[model samples]
Target: MEKNPAVAFNQPNHLPVCDWLNRAIDQGLNERTAPLARALMRVQEQLTWRYGYERMRPGLARKYAYAELLGSNGPVISENLILSVVLFAPKHIP
Candidate 1:
C-alpha cells in the first residue's frame, strides 16, 4: 500500500471490494434467512422514505464503499444483535 497506492483499485484485483464482500458473506451466513431479509428490506425502505430515494441511494452506496474499504464485512448480526436487543427491552406492567 505504501509503495503502490494505486493497488486500492488496481488491475491485478479484478474485484477487490466485491471479492471481499463475497468472501465475508460466504462464511456462516445462510442466504435463506427470510425473516432477516424482510426486516432489512423494511429498514432500507424506511431509510429510503425518510431520506428520499436519490439521497438514500447514493448514501447507501457510499456506506457500502466505506464498509468495503474498512473491511467490515463480517457475518450478519441483525438477527443476533437486533433480536437480543428487542428481547431484553424493559417489560412494563400496569
Candidate 2:
C-alpha cells in the first residue's frame, strides 16, 4: 500500500498552517509561505479597520497567540464509523 501525500493535508513535512500565518504577519518574511498576505490583510481590514486612534475594546483576540492559531490545522476530511455483528466499517478505512 502506498500513502498518498495529497490526501494528507496538515501533516508535518507538508504544508504547515503556522508557516502560512508567519508569512502573513511579515510580508517580507518569505514569499512561498505568505503568498496570500494581500488577500488575508484585505479580509482583516474589512472586518476590523475602523478602530483607528479611537480606543477600542479587544474581544476574542485578547488572549490569542500565534501557536494557538497555527495549531488549528483541521483534519483532511471527516470520517464516520459503523459497527455491526460481522465487522465494523469506517468511512476512512480503505
Candidate 3:
C-alpha cells in the first residue's frame, strides 16, 4: 500500500467546497487517473453541505487516497483533508 501526497487547502480557507472538488478533479484528470477522478466526481455529487474527511470511516478515507493521489510525482490534486475536517466536520456531526 502507498500513501497519497497529502495536500493542504487552508492558506486562505475561503474556497467553496464545489470549487475545491473541481480543482482536485481537474488535477486527477490531468494526471490521467480517470477512474479515481471519476470516483471523486461522484463524491462531489454525493457530498453534503457539511461533508468532510472526518465524517468518513477510516476505510473510506483510505479509499480516497488512491495511487493517483500518491503518484511518484507531486500530487496532481492537492487539498488538505484535515483542514476540510476542521472546517466542515463540525456541521456534519450527528
lDDT of 1 by residue, 1-94 (tens): 1232221221112211232333333331566755544544343212211111344443243223221111112122122221110111112311
Q: On lDDT, who's better, 1 or 2?
A: 2
Query: Which of 2 and 3 is the better model by lDDT?
Result: 3
List where candidate 1 sits over 4 angstroms from the true fold. Answer: 1-30, 48-94
Better of 2 and 3 by TM-score: 3
Q: What TM-score quantifies how close candidate 3 is to the native fold?
A: 0.31
> Which pairs of residues have clashing backbones in candidate 3?
7-80
- Candidate 2 regions exceeding 4 Å error are 1-24, 27-31, 48-61, 65-94
Top candidate on TM-score is 3
Instruction: Give the candidate number with the greatest lDDT.
Output: 3
- The sequence of per-residue lDDT tens digits that candidate 3 reaches over residues 1-94 is 3255544222221224333456567767878687767875664443333324457665333223212222222233343332122111222322
Please give, for residues 1-94, the per-residue lDDT of candidate 2 as tens digits: 1232123223223122222433344653357636445544443322211112245345322222221111123122223321111111222322
lDDT of each: 0.26, 0.28, 0.39
Report the Cα lDDT for residue 70, model 2: 16
TM-score, model 2 to reference: 0.23
